[model samples]
Target: MVRVLLVDDEELVRVALTAILDSAAGIEAVACDGPEAVGLARSTAPDVVLLDVNMPGADGFSVLRELRALPEPPAVAMLTLLGSDEYLHAALRFGACGYLLKDTEPHLLIDCVRILAGGGVVYVPPQSRAVMGTHVNVPLPAPAAPELRGRVTGREYEVLALLAAGLSNTEMAERLGVGMTTVKTHIGALKKKLGAPSRVALAAVAHREGLLDTASADRP
Candidate 1:
């Protein structure tokens, strides 16, 4: 059986996650808030831990550090609403094998949990690939993607599409014949407008939103 731990301050979230994971075949799920997490994980020895980043007393990063230090540590992942680079970096630095957005669909969540349990890593917004670069083990996925109609500026959308296509910031600047600063500005705006956390996520969002499909989109 695959043992999974769901950690979140929100009662509803914990319950919901537990139910979802429990419903999956060959998986057993247990949940607790941040303060109770390390203890629960130690006692239960879950195969995978889905930790929440922002919590009252003991935050996710600290708990994650403790979990990784266990004599027989389980695969840990940060599951949070905020998708910022700072949190993503901290999770990786602290040894989280996965960094997932809370808004993730149910099936994808299960797949990520399974992957992490079986000694694998999952990076949410493929853009993290460029930043982290083979630091962890994983496979690339081709998502179905979404539609983006006037949600971002034309330049920003172009940057995002190029980002999805696996172009680095330096590469993108050269491709667009713009200064690095200009490219950075467009990326920042894209993240703010689209609520993406990191450049990797920006790229992931680019593919998720299918920005390339509408390269001719209207700009403001």
Candidate 2:
């Protein structure tokens, strides 16, 4: 069975989501407030976590970071009402396995939980991409790459696509069937070639460059 931890501030929201998740087969979901998320997660050691983006006390991102630091971190998906690129970008930076809207279909939500548990990823909705494409105002830090003008290799494009998919360094390495050192090299090369400073910036560039589309991320 896939164990899921659902964290949200609103009681109604938690109850609703828990009902949907519990209705699915081979999945057991438990609900909790934002403040108790980390503690519950540690005790339960769930396989997947559905966390709300905005909550009192500690936001999803902070909780997400703490979860990632655990001895065995669960796959976390940021459940949010907002479809803003800012939230999506932040979720990726914090190593979230998925970014889903509050209005997502019940079936899809259940499937996403299973997917995350199976080592797959889910991202923002298609409509969110249109909004993301127009969001060039997101701050891109100074580049650490040596060159700004260069060619992006085929493998680097693959890396960019996976990076945009919000996979962490370790996740990307596993997905690509490569070593961590190789993955790091590709990422550094992408940053230099694209003149990007952070993973968020790399993801933005991937979207802008058409490597990361709404449904799937593909290499050019």
Candidate 3:
């Protein structure tokens, strides 16, 4: 079984995550309420740590740093309410294996745990290409060949904008009043045109092209 240490302040989140992880075929979830996480993880020697970003004390980043400093650091995946590049980059830089959003689909969340166990870096939904720094150097994605631009439609642009803004398919569907399938179709087409490997890369390409302005404007 893949032993997991779940660290979050909220009782409900911890319970829900434990339920999800434990119910899965080959995983066990050990819950920790707050700053007690590092000690528990050290004692248990879990395979992975599903850490929350905003804790009462010694927030996730600090916990992660301490974990990495350990002689045998377990894989860590952050569970965060905020999806900003600053948090994502910090987690990754501090040796986190993956970053996941709080409102993730149950199945997806389980899959992410498995992926992290298998030594993969799982990017969260609505992948943002922005990095942490004052220097903003957005590069064009190589996949969007010259011919593809001639075929991009208006809706495709909208999808790219939303992707750049880190909105998930479900979120985008609600905002745009469309079905998830419809949103996915646009995303696939955008990927084909832009040659982006994933939505996050696509968002980076969109930002390079200045398509995120519309979506950013929509935000308060």
Q: Which candidate is the best by lDDT?
A: 2
Q: Write the per-residue lDDT of candidate 3 for residues 8-73, one digit (tens) a residue.
A: 999999998999999999999999966898899889998789999988876789998888767667
lDDT of 2 by residue, 1-220 (tens): 9999999999999999999999999999999999999999999999999999889887889999999788877888899888777787677666677789999999989988887875566775676555445544454553333233136666776777777665666687888899978987897777667766445556766555554452243332
TM per candidate comes to 0.60, 0.63, 0.59
**Candidates in descending lDDT order:** 2, 1, 3
- Per-residue lDDT for 1-220 in model 1, tens only? 9899899999999888888888899999999999999889878999889999999998789898789778777878899888787777677566677889888999999988887765456778645655454322222232333424456667776777776665656677888999878986887677666655444444545555556567645443
- lDDT-wise, the better of 1 and 3 is 1
Looking at model 1, residue 211 earns an lDDT score of 65
Error of 1 at 140 (Å): 25
What lDDT is obtained when candidate 3 is compared to the true structure?
0.73
The lDDT for every candidate, in the order shown, is 0.74, 0.77, 0.73
Error of 2 at 41 (Å): 0.8
Show the lowest summed lDDT stretch of 10 residues, model 3: 128-137
Which 10-residue window in model 2 sums to the lowest lDDT?
141-150
